[model samples]
Each structure stands twice: as C-alpha cells, then as structure tokens.
Target: MVPTYLERFGDSVKFELKVSLPQNTLPKNTVYELIPSFRYGSQVYAFDKKLGFSSDSIGPYVSPQTKASFSMPYRDGMEKGRLMAYGQLTHQKTGKSLKTGEEVLAEGIITTSELSQIGQYYIDESIPVMGLSVKYGDQDAYGMYKDGWTELQRLFMAYSNLGFAEKSEYMKVIEGRGDFSHKNLLFMELKDYDKVRKDVLPRFDRLAAVSMATTEKSEMEIALLSRQIRKGEISAALLNEAELAAAVDLEPGLGEKEVLLKRMCEVHPSAFSFNNLGVVYLNLANRSLDRTEKNRLLASASEAFDQSNGFFENPYAAYNIGLVYWMMGDKASAYNAFYRAMAITRLDELRKVHEAALGAVSIYNGDYRLAVIHLNKAEKNEINLFNQGLANLLAEDYYNALIQFEESAILDISNGYPFYGMALIAARNGEEIILYENLSKAVSRSAYLRKRAPLDMEFIRYHDKVGFKDAIR
Candidate 1:
C-alpha cells in the first residue's frame, strides 16, 4: 500500500494515515493496533493508546498486536510560525509502519511598514518575556538576555526612525548620567521639527520649566534642545526667551554670562559654542556706530575666529573674519582671509567669499580680466549672481553685466544691488528708457542702495548726470 501524506498550511500540519489489517484474525483477543508518529528536525513525537488518551490518539487494542492499518489526523509543531515534519503509523507489537512524505511551510517577504508594526509587537511582547524571564532566570542572566534585548530593540528602532547612528547607541544612554528618556523624547521631536513646533512646542516650553527645577535635568534638556537648534530643526527665535531665562537662572549678570561663554569656548573648543561666540562679536561689530568701537569689535571678532580655528578649521569662521576685514577697508587682508577660507572649505558660502574677495581685489588692482574670471566662477555657483553682475560692471562689460544683473534680480526681487548695477550700465550706454526703468526699480527695492549710489564709484559717470540722478531718486 502507498504511504500516508501530510500537508502544511501556515504554522499547522494535517496528515492522513492508512492502516491495513492482517488477512486473518484468530480470536476476539487479537490486538489490532496502530501508533501515529511524527518527526521534526531531530525531535520525534508519538501518539499511542498506552501514553494516555489524547484527542489525536487513534486505533484500537486487541489480545494480540495484529498487523492493521488506520488513518489518523494530527495538528503538531506549533513553534516559530513554521511547520516541517513527516508522519507515520505503526503497530506497537510489530514495530512496523508506513511512511509519510515530508511537509513544510514558511513565511517570507515583509514590507517596511509591516516590519515597523512587527517591531512594535515585539516590543510589547518583550514586557511579558521580561516578566517571565525574571521569574525563571537569575538576575544577571535576565539582564543580559531578556531585558537587554528589549532595550536594544527599543533604542535601535527609535534611533533608526530618527535617522540617528544605529550602532548600539543605547549603551551611551545607559552609561550617561543624564535622563535618557527625556533625551530620546527630544530626539523624536527634533526628527520632525516643524511638526513638533506646530503641535508640541507650547507643551515643551511648559515641560522645560518643570525640567529646570533641577540642575542636572535642566542641563541635559538644554543640551538636547541646543542640538536640535544647531541641526536647523528648531528656529533660534523659538528658544530665545528660554535660553535667556536659563542664562539668568544659572548666572546673575549678562557680563558674567559673557565670561562663562568665553570659558565654555576655552573648555569645549570643538563645540559650536566657540563658533557662536565669534558670531556674537561679528554681530557687535556690524552694529557699532563709533569707528573706534567698530574697529575694536572687529579685532575682537578676529581673535574669536582665531580661537575657533584652533579647535576646528571651520570655513565659516574664516569667511566671517574676511568679511570683517572687508568692512574695515583692509582689502589685502580680506582677500588673504577669503582665500584661506576657500582653501579649507568647499561650502557654497565660502565660494561667495572667494568671488567677493576676488572681485574687490581685481577692481582695486585694475585687473578687470581677472575680475571677470573670478566673477564668472562665482556666477557658476548660482548663489553669487548679483556679485557677478557687479564684477562685470567693474570689468566694463555692460551688455553681459546687464544680463547677469537681470537674472539675479529675477531670482530675488528684493535684491537691489543687481538693479543698481543694471541701471548704471544702461545710463552709461545712453539707453535712457532702460536706465530710468532699472533705476526706479532699484530705488523701489532698496532705499539704502539708492542713497549710497552717489558714493558708488561704479556709477561715477552717471552720478552727476541730471537724468540719471533724477531717475535714481
């Protein structure tokens, strides 16, 4: 007779067994018997009448264990969401049986959304696993296996979703002195800053106050919030009041705060706090009305920039110093600083510095060809088109200059420099219609640019012209 067969369906198995009786049975006491057996990997399971009554048990007993056959159905192998096994039925007395074919079933292909859901399920399941493992296992073993796995999965999933480095960063949180829960919560909010600001910022402000009741908790919260701001997720304005309050809470006076900031720069040179202090000095220089104060602040800015360079050769620091020198009218020093910044960084802002410095140097040195070369390179960056237009004006290339200026003005409607350059170019070329239109636009765009036009050497020829003066004003 043919052997029995089993079919597998998603974590369950069903099998059919066939049993045949002996050709002759002598007496009523003769045993008619069969035992169902299953094999999965190396483990074997059997169903027999002697083992005790089971719902899956089959066959009848008789005086003698006769050669008989019977069919039995079974549901077995219930772990790991998979089933792989074969089945058979044998005579207990004869120890002989018919074979069944192997059957297997498995799960494959999981979507990202499904994986996320599965991860959540695993996290939830881990709580029960932790309870069970703690109850059964020793403390150290439970910590290493069950609780560790749960924590690892939670942290890894959290970090991965937030685009953070995913290589077991949970250990850092565990080992660190600060509150990891608050840190993780802040990280989640920072991952979607606009969403958080819209939905959670107000709540966060209230929570921040509660956090600040303790020094250690307050410092950790501030540090995490600062990281988000530095990453450009949260606006600086959003934290302005909070930061001021914290500063006042921690230290009494603004002067003392400045001193502490300086000390912070010294202690954590590689931190962005040092670069930010340089920015503060640069901002002060920009606002100073007294030439002496402006010069002193600019010098202070340069010192801060130098300090920043000691920790990290940040290009923006070098570029800001270059800007300070340019504002101080030290053209040579400005160009050298810009060149150094350009050499150190390939950032687009540094490219603008290179172009602006090159344009200024070329114009001062009377090398219009070099000015054009540098301006053209700058224009390629797309960000420095207005400066390129100004450089072209200095180079006396009116037609190309007008084109560059027009393109730049189109990109930023409020940019008046390009309009001013175009106006001057048009007036010098005796294009009265174009000159009046562009000059009017320039004056409309920027009152400051219009006021400064008389002092601008690039428009010197048109500055005294009655038509140009009337049109610009």
Candidate 2:
C-alpha cells in the first residue's frame, strides 16, 4: 500500500493497495476473489468494484501482483477508520467458495487539509506601564540605550545658541543644576521648566508627552528637546517623519509601508524606521519567487538592516540582519549577526530568547550539545521543542531527542517536523518498521517531507525498499 494510511484530498479520501499472489496460488479452474471495504465504528461500507484473479491471469512460473486504488467520499466518521481487504478462493466453474481470509490494508485517515484555512490572529490590548526611561548613558553593555553622546552634544549646542532674551534665566537654572555628567544625563520635561521659569521658549514643546515618573532622580543632569528646534518654528522635518512613521506603524501593505517608511527615512532617518523597513523588505523577499527579484530584495533588506545596526545597536536589527545574510548565503556574517543578537538585551523577552537560540546554534557550529542548552532556554512551543529535538538528535542523544520530539508532537499534532525527527532517530537505531511508521505520519502532515524522504541521505539504507518508496509516495 502506497500510504499505509489514508489521506483526504478535497472531499475524497484516497489510497492504494497492493496484493501479491504466490506462484500457483490459483488453480487452473479456480478463481481468487478479493473484496475491499472501509470500516468506521459500527458502519461498514463496501467498495462497488471487486477484484478477481485466475490461473490464466498469471504466467506459469511467475507470481502475480496487482494494485487497486480507491477514492472514497470522505465523511467525518471516517477520520478514524480502517480499510480492509478480504480474500476468497472459489471454484470458477460452480462459483463455490473454498477459502476466505481478511486483512487490514491501511489504518486511519489523515485530514490535515481540513485545517488549511486556519490562521493565526491576535487581539489588540492596551496595557499601562512605565515607558522608556529619560536617563541617557554611554555604557550600553546590552545595547539598550540610544546614542546619549549625540543627544547631549545637541542639547549643549541648543543652550549655547539660545537668544539673549531668555538666555540669562535659562543659564541661571542650568548653572544651578551643577555638572551635567554625560554618563548620567537626563532629559528634563519642558513642562517642569515652565514651572521654574515663566517665559519659557515655545520651541521647547515636547513632541510626545512624558510618562509619569515612578522613581525620583537627581536634578543635577538635564537635557531638553529644544535641541531639535530652529528659527522659532518646531522641526517640521521631524514632525513629518513622526507622522509618516506613525502611518507606517499602522502597518499598511508591504509595498505601501515600504514607500512610506522610505519617505520617513528621507525626512529624518532613524534606527527604528530603518529596522522596520528592513523587516518589510525581508518579508517581500521571502514571499517573492523569482530568483533575481528575491536576490535583489534580500540585498536591499540586508542593506536596510545594516543601516539600522549602524545607527543604533539593537537585537531586532541584528537578528534581521542575520536572517538576510543567511538568505544571501553569507554564513559567516550570519553567524556574527546572530552572535550580536544573542549578546544584546531587549524588553521583548521571547524574541531575545529566540535570537539567543539562533545565536547559540550558529556559534557552536556542529556542536549540537551546546546548541541544545541554549535552545532549552526558549519556551516550550512547537518550534522551540522541535529545534531542541533536532539539536539532541545531531548530538547523538537519541533518548532525549525522542522525548523532545514526542513532546513537540503532542503540543502541535499537525506539525510534521517532530515526527520527521522521530523518524530520523528510528533510522539511526535501525528500527525499519518504526522509521516507516513515523515517516508515514510525517509525510501525511507535510508535503515537503513526502518529496524529501526519498532523496534524504538519512534513509539511504531504505532507498531500495518497497515500503520506503511507497511511504514517500
């Protein structure tokens, strides 16, 4: 049987059954009869077609083989059903029954196609929490801080260029704050300055509201948004860039979002905009099929991510750059980017963990034991668990690999990679039947594995086996 299990395509469940008769099984005047049927629960449905063979159908010395195919209408009850074939030997002349036997051809039906239209979606929820801190520091060991030196320099220049009308009072307040240490600088709220001095400059208005402070800080070090202003008007370019970025954040289609984000960059380039642009390009590249177009998009994505990394050191851009470099076939660069991503810290814990796993895998190269340690840090989701299983399998820890694979399969029943991992372990252990069983389940859930099984070197020993070929088919 080509699929030792049934598979449903569209509205039909289809399968093939192969029956072989030994030489001389059918007497010269006798006919061997075969009947096929499906059984689900208490219901039994027989196939409309019947198969029969006689001595005249086979040559004198050779065994006879035949293949029967069925495309049965799929029903909900048949999901857990079995196909059975019954054999009978009868006298051809009088049609008298002589011997009878029954066997199960295939067990159960895989209806993974039923879940084809399923998709993932998320609900928007608002949560009140502390936002980015006002503190600026150059000791960005984890790459979390923005460029404090650049902002501080701009702040000093802004104060240096202030007009004489309000310069004296502003200087008085600034001088009263003591030394403005670069490492412990703070960006003071313009509203707070308005309380201290009545005639505060209108140019000092903040583009965004400052979140309520949850901790008290020393007033010795302060910076202001007035650094961004010029000639009595707020920075219109910055305002335009912010509006465009907000539109981009609304997540238009990739093409539209790419255009808007590029415009935002042209208006006022920033790490955030470049990183998001890289993500859009990466997505476009992934969805494109033409090799030339895909290469072009990947190159652009790589460039955008590199620009983002140059502007600001962050894990998202590093991880994205790794992905783009990986797709570009630059394995060394990809490994370096992954390493950087692993070293960087971010508020998004899961993304950081995923990047760490990728980094550890790349850093260790083929040292899968160390990779498993890093992968274990990830949450026990299907992808993470499957990766853990793969790492263990490569490390030659078949016992743990099997456990992880099983756990992954249990978590996501429709996922084929876990079963495929189990199949690999079975092949390593020389368990041919177990390999076929798991491989069958794997191919049932994944069309890619169905095409890959025959060509995969892991199954080389079974390449010539009929069962392996049938399973792959």
Candidate 3:
C-alpha cells in the first residue's frame, strides 16, 4: 500500500492499493478473492471484490504484482477509521475454500476538503442610493436637504463587519475631510433656492411647514447605530432606552424624512420623490431590530420602488428594489431586479452592480461556471474579488481561488473576508501552520469571522488541535 493513509477530495476519499504476490505462493489450481473495506467501531464499509491471478484459469501473468485503486464516497465518522482487506482461497479440484485473516492495509483519512465556501448572490448595497445625482460630496446638485445629505453619506459608509468604535472613528474622518463648502454653491443652483423661498414657499405654505420639520443632527449617532444594527450587536428597539437612547435620539431624521417624503408624494408623486421615499424606508429597515418590522419596511420600500419604476425606467429604483429583495432573502426576485437594472443601462460605472448580483446569484444556484464568468467580467474590488475567489473555490479550482484571495487582501488589508478565504484554502491543502496563521490574522481583524471559525466545518479535523483553538480565540 502506498501513502499508508487516504485523502478526501470534495465528497470522496480515494487511495491506491498495491499488492505483491510472490511467485509460487499459491497453487496453480487455486483461485483468490480479495475484499477491501474500511472499518470504524463496529461498522464496516466494503468495496467491490477483485479476483487474483490463477494459473488454472489459463490466464497469462507477466508480473507477480497486482496494482489496484479504490475511491468511495466519504461519510461521517470515517475520519478516525482504518482500511482492511480480507482474502479467501478456493481449490478448483477439491471444491474446498480456505479463509484468510483480515489484513490491515492503511489508516485514513485526512478530511481537508470541507473548507470550500458556498457562494451567494448579494446586492451591492453600497452602490444604491436615494435621490437623483446624490454623488459623494455633491448632494447639493440634487436639491436634497443638508440633513438628508448627511444621512445619505452615513448610510453609504455604514459597514456591518465593523464594530461600533471603529465605525465612530471612521465617521470622524469623514466629517473632517472637507467642510461641505464647495457643495454649498452647487446647492444654491437647485432651481435657485432664492426663487423657491420667495415664489414657491410663499405660494405653498405647507412646503414651509415641511421644511421646518426637517431634523438636524449635530452628531452622526445613527451612523454608529446603523453599524451595530447591521452587525446584530444591537437592535433598533433596544436603543429606545435611556442608556443607548442618544444613539437613536433623533432617529437620525429617518422618521422625519419619511414624513416629509410622504407629504411630498401626496402632492407630487414623481419618480424622484417616490424613489427617495423608498430609500427612506430602506434605511428605516436597516435600523429595525424586529424581524417583522424589518420585513414590513422592506416591503414598503419595494412598493415605493415599484411606483418609482412605473413612473419612469429608473435604474436606481430597480437597483434599490434588488437590494430590498436581497435583504429580505428573496434571491429569485433580487436576481430579476438586478437583471432589470443591467437591462436599463450598460454604463461601465454600473457594471459592479450587475456583475456582482448576477455572479453571486449564480454561485448560490450552484452554477460555478456561470458565476466565474460573471465575476470575471466585473471590475476588481474587495467584494467582487472575494466572491470570485469563493466561486473558484466552489469549482474546485484552488490555485485560482488563492490568487484571487491574495489580490483581494492587497486591495483592503483591513478586510477579514479575504484572509478567511485564504485560511480555508490552507485548511483544504492540509497546511496546518499556514491555516493557523491565516485564521489567526482573519479572526483578529473581524469579530464576525472570529465567531464563525469555531463552527465552520472546514477545520473539523483540527478542532482538537491547540493551534486551531488558539487561532480562533
């Protein structure tokens, strides 16, 4: 027997068995039957029988050795088992059979193939936004209120993987970047706010009332809370108490924005107004703690997006609907919405949205080839590159997946997902030290991944190893 141990690849465990039969070891009139099996505890799994050479059968034998190979589907509890072979010799003339003792062949198995990750389609939540022309640092060009602009900026920066402290620190950096001075002059260009104040506001007193109702936040508390909500560290309902009350004190004006947008929709249900309203509900859902409340908000947002789409073929509205569906775990509906967005526009800037959704959805569907094709078409980024690596991993292309993960790590060192992907590759290759190194680095960077490592089956073989436990801790 070669290797003395078996290795598992994907769902199967395979090994080679070489048997040597010395010349004249068996009588010419005798025949041999060999049975290969795996034994664990009291259970035995047997393979198909193979017949050995017999001179009486008129078979020409050049060599006195028999080389055979076996592959069987892997099962649980087989990891701690041993391989065994049994033989029987039958006399041709006398019709007598002699049973041979069980022979231990090799010990198995190394189950490192369980580390491959299942890929999923995700709506690129970062790209979709409310309002028309609400580009970063250029919210004024779209006639959005300053409070709404601030909320939108925070919404874009929110990351579920980040902790509250990290999120708050990033928010400070954003506020310090520039004092929104350049955007102010651009804001004045919005149909000449001077004209809106003297002509429109005076004509419609209700518009003045709505403008007064717009809430302002001196601090970006909702940004921190949004990160917590996304992380599941805290829920929107819990923030109502005094201890964390400051976080949702003003509700980040999401409520106010909803009220104002609803009033605006009653008077003028334009595509832009309805789309912005949908955006408001989406944010509200992000902050919601209760599953039912979140689902309701997502449904409301989807309906608003549908209304926006009916008024005009708005790509943003389509993309937003896709995001809502994704959050709601409706993969089929999300794919359709994302596909619709791509159909509405082929602009290179929006390629990320289309490629990511389509590729990830393909992965979720177990179509690795299609997922790779879509991912390959997308521009490189931490998110898409990581998904590309995941797609390749699922396709059993470890080499390409490792390359993609390495590239993704280079793009964003702080991102734990790329490191986690590399750790999975290391585990699959049975590189224990490398696995521990990468796993340690990964879990150290993201609290989310730290919690996932112990439960992940990829490292099941090393669960008892000290290095594995320490790395996850």
Q: Lowest summed-lDDT stretch of 10 residues in model 1?
A: 111-120
Winner by TM-score between candidate 3 and candidate 1: 3
Residues 4-32, candidate 2: write the lDDT tens digits.
Answer: 56766545676776668888777787777
| Native-referenced Cα lDDT, model 3 | 0.63
Candidate 1 regions with alpha-carbon error over 4 angstroms: 1-260, 312-314, 346-357, 379-383, 454-466
Clashing pairs in 1: 19-69, 19-70, 20-69, 29-63, 30-63, 30-64, 31-62, 31-64
User: Lowest-lDDT window of 10 residues in candidate 2?
Assistant: 116-125
lDDT of 2 at 112: 34
lDDT of 1 by residue, 97-141 (tens): 554575542221111010011000121121210000011122211
Worst 10 residues of 3 by lDDT: 133-142
lDDT of 1 at 257: 40
User: Local error of candidate 2 at 22, Å?
Assistant: 50
Task: Please state every model's RMSD to the true fold in angstroms.
Answer: 34.0, 19.9, 16.1
lDDT of 3 at 139: 23
